[model samples]
Target: MIPQRKLSLLSNRLARKGGRRVPEAVLERDYCLSWFLVGLSKTPLIDILAFKGGTAIKKCYIPDYRFSEDLDFTLRESVPFEKIQAYLALAFENVEKDSGIKIRISRFDQNVLGLTDLPDSGL
Candidate 1:
């Protein structure tokens, strides 16, 4: 896991470079978003998931694009909701093991998953 202090330092440097404010919360979210996507992709879910949304645009096309607080994906194939939930659970478990970040799914639906970071996670 990237230390919180390191993330703060990086955000500070980016903010200093462009004179644009870099919110620490956004940095934290971005960090989690990246690791979550990586972990998710390693699962079978990758076959069905298609990355999209503002975050994807920012990552693949425009580094300076607006910061996004969440990850968005579209399913390319149909899967039972129960199976999707199971896959998501596996993904979350993988993320925790790999990144040391405890993320709770605060809410979820067919098209959205809202994640919340546990407090004092050491980033």
Candidate 2:
């Protein structure tokens, strides 16, 4: 499990980077990937709480922010955090391979998952 202090530090860093509020496409991708991963482990989605830029989406409302580059999703209960991380890693790798853009996944817990872009290497 990721420590709370570390998570807070990471969040602060991302916020300071001016990461865009998550976009709808990212949200949809996250939902689909999350369901698939959780289903593989037979975990159920009891609830989802999206803090910050996610409040609108959680409420089934449209988001006001455009160009959102980060997404934060909170699951209802805990599960094997490593498994979730593995699933997300694989998912992001696939997306990167397909889109030719680097995608990175980080998980604090079964409850919290983050997706972000990788810095361009100019390769």
Candidate 3:
């Protein structure tokens, strides 16, 4: 659970991106996804995948780049599809078991999106 003080701080920080502050639920989801990604980097996925786009901008380069709900990754080199599959499996399994956040991922060519359930949004 996120402490009230931290949530307020995050919300304040996120408010800088746009004129209005982002909702708490969106920030919570982003925080959850970020935690999942931190665990994901431990798997072989980082060796073959390069974090890119919104996720990178928000988490790496700029913290106030808006809330990114999905994770996007690009292939760093010539890695076999099987290895990539294994990487996803291992990473997701570990994160799910640890966080109880069942992140669903879909891939298209060179991009992958991590889909997650909202705080109270049914389905």
Best by the lDDT measure: 1
Summing lDDT over every window of 10 consecutive residues in candidate 1, give the lowest-scoring window.
110-119
Tens digit per residue, CA lDDT, model 3, 5-64: 888887887577566887788878887887678778889777777788887898898875
TM-scores of all models? 0.81, 0.36, 0.66
Residue 88's lDDT in candidate 2: 56
- Which one wins by lDDT: 2 or 3? 3
Best first by lDDT, ranked: 1, 3, 2
The local distance difference test score of each candidate is 0.84, 0.45, 0.75
Poorly placed runs, candidate 2 (over 4 Å): 1-52, 55-60, 63-69, 105-123
lDDT of 2 by residue, 1-123 (tens): 234555556556645665543333445454444343333233222233223455335333553443334444555445566665666566556544444444544534332333435556799
Ranking under TM-score, best-scoring first? 1, 3, 2
